[model samples]
Target: GNNSGNLANISLDDILNERVKELYWEGFRRSDLIRYGKFTGDNYLWPFKGGVLSGQGVAAYRNLFPIPASDIIANSNLVQNPGYN
Candidate 1:
C-alpha cells in the first residue's frame, strides 16, 4: 500500500540515526558503525583494550579495540583512548 515513491530518498545516515536511538544504551553503536563503514577515518578510532595496552604498548594504528572504563582504571600502564581523555 506504499505510495509516493519517496522511500528511495532515505539515506544510510537516516537509518543509522534511528537505530542508534533504539539501541543507544544497549551497546550496539560500535558494531553498527563498524559494519556500516561509519567508524574509522580521520576522526574515529576504536578504543584499545586496557589489558592489551598494559601488556603491550598503546596499539598501533592498525590495532584498536574498545576498552571499557573499568579496564582503564584497573591498569595504570594503559593509556586512555586518544580523544576520550
Candidate 2:
C-alpha cells in the first residue's frame, strides 16, 4: 500500500526512541545511537553520555572509528577511517 500519505517527517527524538524500542538489547544499541547523533552530543543523551547523568557530546571524530593499528601496519594500501590518521 502507498502509506507515504500517512507518514510525516519524524523528529530525531522519535527516530531515536523507535530505534531503542525496535533494537534495544539486540546488539545495535550503540551503533543505532551513534547513527542518530543520540549516542554522542547533547541532542539526545542518555545515562553517562559524557560521564555525567545529564550526558555530553562525544568527539565528532569518534563517529568514525579508528582503523586498527595492526591492519594499518599490515596493509600499506589501506587508509584509516575518517577522523583518524
Give lDDT tens digits, candidate 2, residues 17-55: 787788877888778777766666666666777788877
lDDT of 1 at 52: 43
RMSD of every prediction: 11.0, 5.2
Residues 1-85, candidate 1, lDDT per residue (tens digit)?
Answer: 1486556577788888899899889998868866876565423333453334333233233234657789988997888766556
**Model 2, CA-based lDDT:** 0.75
Off by over 4 Å in 2: 1-11, 82-85
Quality of model 1 by C-alpha lDDT: 0.62
Error of 1 at 63 (Å): 7.2
